[model samples]
Target: MPHPNPDAMAFLLSRRSRPAKTLRAPAPDRAALEPILTAAARSPDHGKLEPWRFIVLERGALHRLAGLVEERGPDLGQDADQIAKAASAYRDSPLAVVVVEIQKSSEKIPQIEMTYSAGAVCLALLNAALASGWGANWLSGWASHDRAFVEQGLGLSADERVAGIIHIGTETSAPPERPRPDLDTITEWVTE
Candidate 1:
């Protein structure tokens, strides 16, 4: 029989992502964050491709990206509000881990699987932060997808794109529990 870990199950059931906007300063330094990143790297990768990587954005780097967004927003035909929202995330965030998805060409392994691996890395990073008693949230906005913005600000290559930006910091306020999807509506019991 498989050994049961009630504590692990209980933690998973209760884990909730704190809103990125609600996160505060005094973010984890490199030494403190290394373990979290290491934990995230353990996410599943089909065919052992390890097709994802992390970019740790510290406070100064975040501000730089914020400036890039401010300059590029107008060029992208983004409204003032849209630009503000895009820049605010970077400017306000104490720390943001950019989960970059790299599309590797392979015959045996599909590109779709690599994309999935990148997505999994994002979630794993968020969960790791939360499990370590830190506020965390996974986010991706228009700025994240814009080629110019990503290339100039984050320096992603042609074959790379942002899967998610996982913000980690101290929680200022406890977010209220939101509605959850009912299993009856979303699940299927196919025993045929």
Candidate 2:
């Protein structure tokens, strides 16, 4: 007999990311978010490098980041719509956690593995936020990719990069569920 966590399995089966546009205010405060961060830190890291970090952006920081997005857009050759969309993500976010991928020097662990660890941390953070009863969405756009935007807005080091920015807040409306992928189309069976 095997002991399985039905509740955890149920949540994973039905989990859906709430769209950032539909999320409102009343995000988790520092005290409330501490456990979420702790949970995210538990993600697997090859070599135990812990090749990732968190940057919690509060309301004021989000506002400044929005302005920084606008300032960097033109210089980065972004169009008006692109700039607006990117800026709006920061402007409208009640709170966000930027998952910074740290490239650690490990002879045994390749850089790709470190990147994978960071990505896993991002998913863990999103799941933690959702399980805490907050609406959460993982997002990254042109602004997040632009070097100048990352350096100026996020103060990321040369070896660091944005893995994902997770927006957390109250849900203004419940979005309709979209169609999921067919397992047969994507799954593969190997007996070799």
Candidate 3:
């Protein structure tokens, strides 16, 4: 027999990502966010490599990142619209957590697994924030992927990469539920 947590299941099923632009101030403070970060840290990490780290960006940092996006966007071949969108995301965000994936040299654990673990941490952070009554959205764009921007904006070393940038704050409006993938269409049953 297996025990089922209906409340958790229901929450999971109904979980929705809040738009970063629609999120406002009054974001979670350090105390409020500590537990959320803790929850996110509990995500699965194969071989216990712990290859991910979090950088909590305050409003000032967000604004700085927005400027960096503007500076580096044109060089990266991002058009004006793309630059504006990405810059506005940082400029408008109340707070954010940059999930930095640090690749570690391991004899047994492969690098891809570490990358997957970092990705898991990003989702976990987003979900934890949402579950804790905060609007959260995970974003990655040209700025996040650009080497120069990342190194300058985040001080990421060569071994580090941005897994995701998770914006968290108060919700300004309730977005309509978008259509979800049909599980039957995406899932395949396997048996041996």
Candidate 4:
């Protein structure tokens, strides 16, 4: 016999990511967010490599990031809207967690596996935030991909990559439920 946790399942089924732009103030306090980060850290990591780390960007940090985006814009040939969109994540966000994938040199654990673990951490963080009653969204723009931007903006190392920027805050409006994948089309049952 197996015990089923219906509430957890129901919550998973109903979880929807709130838009980053629509998230407002009064984000999770340190006490409130600590547990969520703990939950996120519980994500599966093969061989326990722990190839990921998080940078919590609060209000002032966001402003600094926004300023960096503005400063780096022209050099990257980004126009106003593009620059604005890149900066908007910081400009509007009350709080965000930058999931950084730190690639470790290991003979046993492959780099791809490390990358996957980092990705898992990103989703775990997002889900944790949502489960904790905070609106959260994962975002990565051109700035996130730019080498200079990552190094200068977030102080990432050569072996590190941005897994995602998980923005968390109060939800201003409820987003309508979007379409889900058709299980029949996506799944295949095999029998011998």
lDDT of each: 0.93, 0.94, 0.95, 0.92
Q: After superposition, how far is residue 97 of candidate 3 from its true place, in Å?
A: 0.2
Model 2 Cα lDDT, one tens digit per residue, 124-173: 99999999999999999988888888898899999999999999999888
The runs of at least 3 residues in candidate 1 whose Cα sits more than 4 Å from the true structure, single-residue gaps closed, are none
Q: Pick the candidate with the highest lDDT.
A: 3
Candidate 2 regions with alpha-carbon error over 4 angstroms: none
What local lDDT does model 4 show for residue 159? 93
Q: In angstroms, what RMSD does candidate 3 have relative to the true structure?
A: 0.9
Worst 10 residues of 1 by lDDT: 45-54
Q: Model 4, 60-82: lDDT tens per residue?
A: 98999899999888899999999
Residue 94 displacement (Å), model 1: 0.4
Mark the 10 consecutive residues where model 2 has the least summed lDDT: 142-151
* Candidate 4 Cα outliers beyond 4 Å, as residue runs: none
Candidate ordering by lDDT (highest first): 3, 2, 1, 4
Residue pairs with backbone overlap in model 2: none
Give the distance in Å from residue 6's predicted Cα in candidate 2 to where it truly belongs.
0.6
TM-score for predicted model 3 compared with the true structure? 0.97
**How big is the RMSD of model 2?**
0.8
